[model samples]
Target chain A: MARTAGSHAETTGPKVRAVALRLFARYGYAAVSMRQIAAEVGVQAGALYNYTPDKQGLLMSLMQGHMHDILEARQATSSEGDAVQQLEAFVKFHIGFHLARPEALFVSYMELRNLEPQNFARIEALRRDYENELEGILARGAAEGVFTLDDPKISTLAIISMLNGVVNWFRPDGRLGLGDVEQIYWGMVRRAVGAAE
Target chain B: MARTAGSHAETTGPKVRAVALRLFARYGYAAVSMRQIAAEVGVQAGALYNYTPDKQGLLMSLMQGHMHDILEARQATSSEGDAVQQLEAFVKFHIGFHLARPEALFVSYMELRNLEPQNFARIEALRRDYENELEGILARGAAEGVFTLDDPKISTLAIISMLNGVVNWFRPDGRLGLGDVEQIYWGMVRRAVGAAE
Candidate 1:
């Protein structure tokens, strides 16, 4: 049955989004249900409709919303600097930003297909923007002759590939600290970008 | 209700696994189920049990079995060479092997968590061994200074990351041929591990 304004105010829209993000990260989008989300959030499945019209809406909110916020955050923090600092900020942000929200990273990365075609296109554009962010940085560094790579597209794809790989194996309780993780990835990124002196 | 089988051949163990892989690749592991798999394989849900015990077993078989076969294929065709040649061969194998069997790659990489603890550990070990294959090459190259990496583990990890990222985007129908894909990746890999000329 469809729900209307009968839902309670104690459960806000953002709370529903947070719950959905965590569940999608754990169980994936298709594997999760309105009932499961409601059960975990202490609301009725119909109450979830108070926030999202459907599960696909929840996934779209999780991905496109999170990515938009990420792009905004990176934009706000970005500064004009020497190519190295710009690159460092980009690298650090890529690593630190993802570490701060593993759920968002995992779910957004894993659940692209669950979106409606129009929604998928929007989310894909946001992700492509994120990819292009570093491509610009690499192109700037390369144009200055400080960086040496044959093709920025291949190099950009490669650097992103290496950086994104960090999420798969990173562990806070493991021997490495987050700073160490950043530095190690930064080191390799430096080499790959021909930034190391 | 459980399925009753007349003979061992009546069990759809292998057939179910095959169908699961194809569907998991095309749709996704999370979106698939025993019923869907059964429907595709032309078997009843009850008949699925003859092949394996449960959904998790089917996922494990797709993963552990796939990795076993991948390792075997590599062992057969994998050549002995200095770290550079071995690395190229590994890159070629990684791309060729995955491009050929996207279904297996999709299931193994995506459905890892679906495995029970023992099953997860066993498949993880196989993954570690595969990782170690690249690590061995990196370690050899680092020792000879053919690879000027600050950390072999990072190089190993990064190489695998770049290679695996191919599956997320590569399409046979794309303008880039398999050989073109291999060449592009090899150029990046060569620069990554090439002797400091």
Candidate 2:
């Protein structure tokens, strides 16, 4: 529940995690010191100890938060639909999630090494859980003869790879709008899975 | 040249660039110092200047070199073939290029902002050239009625996005061999284009 932005118990855990995420993204995690985070939050260095034991814990909390949101977002967005519908919902939610939260993207990919081995593997497994969700969807689609694929697992990775890529090249002010981006990704996903428009 | 481990430079350049790239990747471009690079390369700080005018220039050169290789790989591998063949070649080439040379991958994504505005745009344009090549292939495939794509440009980005993602999860000792990974990627690309298996 506690995070590393500042030790001030008055600050909410999520708020502290947000601050630390932005800082870690801008400045690499190792480059930023605990004192700097305390300064940013207007709290005493000793105060941050109340929230997080160390910088690594803060990173773990931040990553886990993001991974968990992704899981919840997919679960929340998905409905009683077939494979394509579920996959579409997942893709839309994924792009929307990362685009809306660049700080989370930074923390998940950039600060993984900062997590202790046990914590790092834990979050990594959670992240893989999202992948598994997609894989299951692909398998169902293929099994139902709605989607065609030689190998469902590899196909799922390819789809996720392309979908996850939106965060790297997409810009809010860029030439394309969000809806178009979603449609574009869906179109590609369909093609990748041998589904027709 | 005396570039550091995993530098993109050929033999023609000086050693400073190599040392700097290796150091920057290890310690981050912002965290590394010109003196440290000089020390690594067994040269005095003053002598390092004779090779690169400044740290920014060194960073830009590395970026430029990476972009050049990417563009070159796109050109070299994507020639004298039909759209489908060219695209398959392109995808496999992309995986091979990136995996075989992590240096380019590290610079293109990790050390992007270190470039000066003018230099940065130059590198970006090279990347765009590669993207355009993919777009052209997809568009051609669609036009030939061999492929189905709603948006060639976005599909190109989507596929490349998936391809670039190999960096985050790929491990040589893993169960899947590199060839298997390439086959998986190619299969996805083919399906995504709506090409027959």
Candidate 3:
């Protein structure tokens, strides 16, 4: 009996999160309920509690998971180059990572207002850490005289926002492949930062 | 009595929209109900139908209204200048207009998925029209050899996305004033297209 429950929970935990994310992304977070999430997960409402304490907990977990995933993915990529190369890697990584997880990206951006203050701060910190990575690249480039920037911090936000906009309209089977899109953006980014050719 | 009723609706119409926009921005559209909107508008639930056919209509109207407002605002701005000057106006106008109406911008972006298909199409057409305005400038600039771009269409989306990001974190009281932010972004925009100095 104990072994069965343990295995069930291991499987069910992921199921609960998946269902919850879909429902929340489809409908706004406030519009989704724990009971509804449970129904979608094929579990009793009581069983959901065994996986997540409540809706807020589930939201925080999803957001935090997204942040951590992106940060980890960013960490795994090569950062062993000059500022221009580092900036290129950052741009490509950001676009590819965000494109692959549209739902998580949507939820993370859209549901920010719903996060409780404490949860908001935690998520913001993680986000800042991510932003800081790009800012660091810009700063290094500016310092090395390879790139000209009025404000590295503002440039960081502008570059990320421009890249994030890709997920809004990019289709994998569209006329342009991902590589083409990345190259186009990198060209613009390189120019935008006044990077040396 | 008819005149009085007409006048009442004229006054109440904007209120209903204002309340709905605020509520929808605060809570996702699905989580907000017609009754909640009516209550906030200080009217009976059924009376909201007089203002809007249903919750969807309200959402559609808000999104449509936002698009029209921006389009009209863009039209009002002077498009008379060299391509570089026109692009500068666009970047500055975009950031200022969007920043001034954060709630509308937020709802317009976040509730796009919630728009009914027909409504979505209408809003998209308007958005595309807005995008084309920028594309025209880029095309002109490229043709005139004032700006270099790999793809004018892609560059248009990228520039607008970068500018639209200002609303996400810009504060009037923050370290940068609107003018300072605009100038910084303008510099980046000019460089991003490889415009002649």
Which prediction has the highest TM-score against the true structure?
3
Model 1 alpha-carbon miss at residue B153, Å? 2.9
Could you give the TM-score of chain B for each candidate, in order? 0.89, 0.85, 0.90
Query: What is the TM-score of model 2 when looking only at chain B?
Result: 0.85
Q: How do the candidates rank by TM-score, highest first?
A: 3, 1, 2
DockQ, candidate 2, comes to 0.47
DockQ of 1: 0.43
Complex DockQ per candidate: 0.43, 0.47, 0.67
Q: Per-prediction count of colliding residue pairs? A: 1, 12, 0
Put down candidate 3 lDDT per residue, A1-197, tens digits, no spaces: 23344448778899998988888878778877888987877776888888887789999999999999999999999799899999999999988888788788878988988899999999999999999999999999999899989999999999988988887878888888888889999999999999978
In candidate 3, which residue pairs get closer than 3 Å at backbone N, Cα or C atoms, i.e. clash? none
Cα misplacement distance, residue B118 of candidate 1 (Å):
2.2
Give TM-score values for chain A, per-prediction.
0.91, 0.87, 0.92
Q: Assign candidate 3 its CAPRI class.
A: medium
| Tens digit per residue, CA lDDT, model 3, B1-197 | 12344448888899999999999988778778888987887777888888888789999999999999999999999788899999889999998888788889878888988888898899989999999999999999999999989999889889888888888889879999989898999999999999866
lDDT of 1 by residue, B40-117 (tens): 877687788877878777777778788999899889984887778888899999999998887788778777756678
When sorted by lDDT, best at the front, the candidate numbers are 3, 1, 2
